[model samples]
Target chain A: MGTKAFWLATTAAVLIVFAASRLVTNDYVFFAGYVVLQYVVLATAWNILGGYAGYINFGTSGFVGIGAYSTVVLHKLVGPPIPVLILVGGIVSGAIGLGMGYLTLRLRGVYFGIATLAMAIVVQTLVTNWDFVGGSRGVYIIRPAHVPFIGGYIQYLFLVMLVLAAVAVAAARTIERSVFGFGLAAIRDDEQAAEVSGVPTLRLKLIAISVSCGLMGMAGAPLPYYVTYLDPASAFNLGYTANTIAMPLIGGTASWVGPVIGAIGLATIQQVSTVTISSALNLLIVGVLLLICVVVAPNGIVGLVRGKRRRAGRGG
Target chain B: MADDLLSVDKLGKRFGGFVALDGIDLTVRAGERLGLIGPNGSGKSTLVNCLSGTLRNDSGTVRFDGNLLNGLAAHRRTRLGLARSFQLPKPFRSLTVVENLRVPLYYSVNARPGAPHLAEAAVGERCRELLRLVGLEAKADRQPQDLTQIEMRKLELARALAAEPKLLIADEAMAGLSNSEVDNILALLMRLGDRGIAVILIEHIMRAVISFSQRLVVLVAGRKIADGDPHAVVRDPEVVRAYLGE
Candidate 1:
């Protein structure tokens, strides 16, 4: 489908889900649903560079941290609306992404992976030292008692995240089918071959990194409002890194739908397990699921299903 | 020299202390068919790399169609109409046979000034034509892994052709093929030459290179030892001593 049509359909679906959630009297659904939706955005954003271009980014939380801090700084200065804050977050993170790509894209394979991991640590250290966003002590956000139309602040946050998820998924789907996506796929398969074949490899990679980081930052922009107490440690939590990478790997990295499916499935499990058991086991569950994915479905759930279908077709 | 489509002046490359290509001077006229041959570890592949901008030459200059090609990136060189197939045939593993041709068409061909702005349908049409040219229309949807070794080589050649290049370098494109398969590739290279595309065929298969090349160039120990009529160059004493070993 064309991007416009896909976007319209996704928006319609999100609205319907939001409308259905309104029927539930309890506020807990929105609280948990917000997180699941947040991963949906994070996973989709990460996949743009990590899955599509075959560059593994271990610093997802760094981009998210940038977004959250950008929001914190903006709130301190002018206290802009969430949308404006989100825009600023995306732009700042995208510029950093472009800079990071320029400095590190020449290093491939494990070296590139290490550079991104180190980048996350660097970002965390920087945020810890910077006092504008309250340094290591953290900052508290007092949300308005009642949201304009959504009634509850939590519900409003949920609705915003839902919209962002729709936007992220629609964007990914569009890129997956475009000429630009084909160039990325070529780069992923073989950088040298792609270059000799006339693909502008470095330029395409930088664009991927910028877009991926921008969307990730957008996902993080609303975090301060959601949690009320935002710290450098929480903003740059390594859990964000693990979950974002896990979602795409578990769902399938080849297509846009893979990361969305992975995020929704994995995040929902994590939320349910958190309530029924303990939050400490959340990372354990992720590790186990990732292990399963690596062993049994190395290409993820989508790849497994596609393999079965192809085999059945051949059999027939 | 003015009519030369590609001119290399004293091209040199070294890997640490080992010289790969030393002051190699060569020229190809428009639509010319030239065969480059040498023993293992000689500089035939290295020369192709320098000309195609895969590896930068430490010294000397390369001019293609009156444009000085020094320090240009590989993709930029391709945009300027120099294309080459790898010796081992590096096909995009994830892309299907036909989509493999689309990369060059979308990037190199369409980027040129006054080139037709190909819509999706036009791109598909062009991809189909390329697949047919390389006799890969039957396997258009198959992954590169599913193709035989010879088929992979054909796909490589077809992908290079997709750029609409002025000059093409086919590096051992028929390495593992049977005699009939080698003849097929030779005929294909000859056909490319007929279309006003200068071709440099680098091959170890002596018979195919001699039958296909109007002129032959021999390299030995990082230096050009012979360049002349194919029959005459083969009989040069130094070429026979260094390469033919007869």
Candidate 2:
């Protein structure tokens, strides 16, 4: 599709969803929808570096926590609007991503993954110790009585998340089609080959990590107001890491649609199962789904569909 | 010497205490076809790596097209017109054959100043032209995984050429190919020479090297044993004893 057409379609789809969602009187749906949309942003962000560049970042919580705490710190200090906090959170997390990439990006494969994991633990510990943002004691955020136009604060949060998800998806699609995306794909295939082929691998990787972390942070920026309580444990929850990584892997990693499909599908399932079954089953489901995806459909759903289509074409 | 496209002086590289390359010096003029032959583990690949900025030299200097490449990263060295194919074909498996060519063309060739900025359609046209040059136009849409061994090598060469290098290093590009396939690669290299792009053909196949090289250099045990006309270099007592000796 042409760029203009793609944007228009995306905008229309988001607006349609927003308008439809308003008809629901149950605030529970909005709360659940907000969580799903948040995963959409997180999964899409993770895939930019992990899927495209083949640099698996295991520190999703680190970036997300940075964003969440950036909001807390900003809200406590300046009492800025949520939009402003989101932007600040993104910049702060992106800067950290850039710094981490510069320091440890030289390590490849498992080593790089280990470094990122270590960084997450370090960030969590630092935040847990600092009392200014409540540290381990946790901080409470007071939501406004009513959101302008949106009515309820939860509904407003859901609307904002919906917009963020659309923006993330659009950004990913643009990168996928651009020359930069090709560079990242080359890096994914072979770093040495990419370098010799005149790709500035280091530069491309730094950009990928920065953008990925930035998006993750933006997704977490509104969490303070949504949850009303912010603590290191909740901010750096392993659930964010697990869900974000699993969603992309289960849906597909190579395309923009994959993470969205994975997030919405898995999040919906989790929400439904949580009410009917057990919350503990969520991790088990994600783990089993990840294993199945890896073994049966290594390229995820999109790849599986393409593979089957190719097979059918050949058979015919 | 001033016009030499690549000049290496006192190059030295060591892994631990074992020296892979020891105080080597070589030069290739613009459009000069030079053959670098050596026994197995004689540091031929090491020299290529050092020159291409893949590996840093312990002690020495490499100047490419008047630019010092000592600390330059491999990609920057490529941007400065130094390009090399790997000993093994390293095509991007996720990309089609044509897309493989586009990576280098988009990043290295079109990225250079004064090179025409190709539109998206022009990029496709240029990719097709590259595939045709390497005679892989019919397999443009094929993934590297689907290609034959020889076809992968051709794609590797095509990828290196996509950078529009002033100096192209083909590191064992014809290895494991059938006799006819070797000739095909040789002919391709000769065509590249005709275009005034200097090539370093590193091979153990003497017949191909002798036919393709204007000058031949032999390395044995991390030291240059012979450097002169191809026929004379092959006949040199030290080169014959160190390399040809079974």
For residues A9-90, what per-residue lDDT tens digits would candidate 2 score against the true structure?
9999898989998799999999999999999999999999999999989999999999999999999898998899999999
| For model 1 chain A, the run of ten residues with the poorest summed lDDT | A1-10
Q: Whole-model lDDT for model 2 versus the true structure?
A: 0.93
Q: Tell the DockQ for candidate 1.
A: 0.87
DockQ of 2: 0.90
lDDT tens readout by residue for model 2, B151-223:
9999999999989899999999999999999999999999999999999999989899999999999988788
TM-score (all chains, Cα) for each model? 0.98, 0.98
Docking class of 1: high
TM-score for chain A, prediction 2: 0.98
| Segments of candidate 2 deviating more than 4 angstroms | none
